[model samples]
Target: MELLYSNILPLGCDDDERTIVGCFKEQMKNSDRVEIAVGYTSNASLNELDALIDRYAIKKICLTIGMYYIEGMPERSYHTALRVNQHWKASGIGEIRIVKPFKYHGKLFCFYKNEKPFSAIIGSANLGVIKLEATNRRQYEISALTINETEVAEIAFHIEQLKTSICSGNISDIKGMPLIRETNTSLDGIELVTAVPQSSVEFYKNCKTYVSFFLKLKVPRSVDRHIDDGKHYTKSNINVCYAAPRNKRKSRDWYETQLTVGSDIYRMEGYPNKNEPFFVVTDDGYWFKAHTTSDNNKQFSAVGDELIMGRWLKGRLVAAGIVKHVNDTALDADRLGMITEEMLEEYGCDSLLFKKTGQTALDEKGTDLDVWMLSFVSGNDYER
Candidate 1:
């Protein structure tokens, strides 16, 4: 037998932190696979959620935000979420797959693998704080329905594309697929449907008719707040904080500190060719902060002869002093300025600096074709 659950708990509803936590604690015990998918509002904390995953050895976690690995070795299983869908994009996770958010009255979906008496749910209840806990609110929302056989297949198919993206590194366009699609029988005596049933044509025309009449039928928005360090800020409480503190050091300074701590450092910046932007990278992106600029006046000036990060040039490092040369003659010099510069050459690898386009105005008086065009014509020869 299948069970269904749904609700109308919007973003600003209540401020309770544990209702959803309790829900997870209760539902997760017997759950072989637990998927916590949230849209406009998020209920679970990254740490608490990850702990749940660890406790249950969850097979999959599809969050709207990029999921983190708070404890154990990264799960071999795929964890997929949208890049712009929510926050926490800087964690450097490998399987950070992108997804789109569902809309209000948009069939919300969750797929739990391994838990029998298949219990599927949809509604306004988000797994988060205000939606479940806060009081002195005008209304609260909740909805849920146990699934019949067909609904099971439908929900399974709804999230299959999401599962494929995490496991195989591919995602399909949601628009191409219907909200509910028929699935072949897998579990006994149950027809399956998509976990997120698309708003029926009738529902689309008039959402209020299908959604619960008890709750005020209006779309809710997440209160805007600053996300500093790793903490999430909401409007109701100005002082909310997270487990991790923000690194106050500027990103570049932190990067430099990590790389120069151990070895003498050197930097080089210039385009190897006209098409490439000048780049400054450390032995590994792990060490020095890399930067790129298109200014032609930024030239290479070094006293050392080492080639670092797959390119040749001159710059200072905190550990190593100024590089003197990029050739055999100047090689013996300590090259170890406070920031030393030595070329640790290796094959099949390059520095952490990735590619990006930079902009500079076109010159008008030089011998270059752009300059010549500008001198000869009425329009600016816009070339760099």
Candidate 2:
């Protein structure tokens, strides 16, 4: 099946990235002309990726040109540890363009101007747990992948224009993409088309539609054998909403979306609804907040973290531990695995930690101390 648009859940996004990486690894073949470009919210890895590209025989590489330093953790080298530039050995990279940072409110965008114009397609996907994870049992995510030549060209040109402006330093009063922030534009030829979020309204719309889209797409699900927790399970007929609250950007006017289940058309502010046990997840960072009243007799709750558990927190849906801030620190896989196992145990999961012989390890300095592991020590764990 040729998907005109395929949703990409990029890596480093919650645990879902393992699924994306698995799928990508399964699909990526020996492409002589392949190019890999990535822009992350925090840092990235290039070493493990080198093996992937070499395994697939990818010919080109396009790594974003920005480095980040998480405050208070100077030894934390998450950004450069697994970088794309390090992947270029022997054959050397065909292109290396620096996508300078552009500001929008408090967010940053890596302007991809140089490469897209000559490309056959164009689209955007974010780098994070929500965008990347697969084992996350609670809420699901979707990426729109397109093969449209013209639409890709247009997007490429637009990026180029933005880049040109940035290069010339003529951006005195730069405004983001106005049309996306205002109206939803459909693609004409793109096979996998993902919309770029330019504002709160645009983000709301994407969340509303994309969640529905993935629900209908039927991407095959895999059994999640979480270490601490029991098998990660997903309940059918679920709904979720994540809104990035507005603090500096313009607020979304009171917009309402209606969700129809069976004979009832239930309405709420901004997001559309699904059946019973609907969960709303939002980054505490959004400008406008999403609210639902019990007036409709619908189940509701708000998840404040970027990485949220799907289903409900009661009865059928239980509380699973969250990956509060994986990006903020640097941890090896064993540390990540240990934390998962420990959390699973803490939350009544079935995984055995020290019992797994191959899993446990001593530090490089020969110390028995665990590496820079991170996770929820408790409720206030994600504050950093």
Best-matching candidate per TM-score: 1
Q: Where in model 1 is the C-alpha error above 4 Å? A: 1-20, 36-46, 59-97, 100-117, 125-153, 161-384
lDDT by residue for model 2 (139-221), tens:
33333333355654554444445334353221112222111011111121222222233363233323312212101111112
Choose the strongest candidate by lDDT: 1
lDDT of each: 0.28, 0.27
In candidate 2, stretches whose alpha carbon ends up further than 4 angstroms from where it belongs are 1-27, 34-45, 65-83, 89-91, 94-98, 104-124, 128-139, 156-384
Q: What TM-scores do the predictions have? A: 0.30, 0.28
TM-score of 1: 0.30
lDDT of 1 by residue, 1-384 (tens): 322232344543244332333444665665655443433332223435555556766554554322222111111111112221122223221222324332212233454655433555555545442233353133454545445657756665554555454422222222221111112122123221112222322222222221110101111122222323443322111111111224533111111111111011122232232222222221111111122222332222111211222122122111111122223212223322111111211010112222222212222233221100000000121111
lDDT of 1: 0.28
Q: What's the true lDDT of residue 68 in model 1?
A: 22
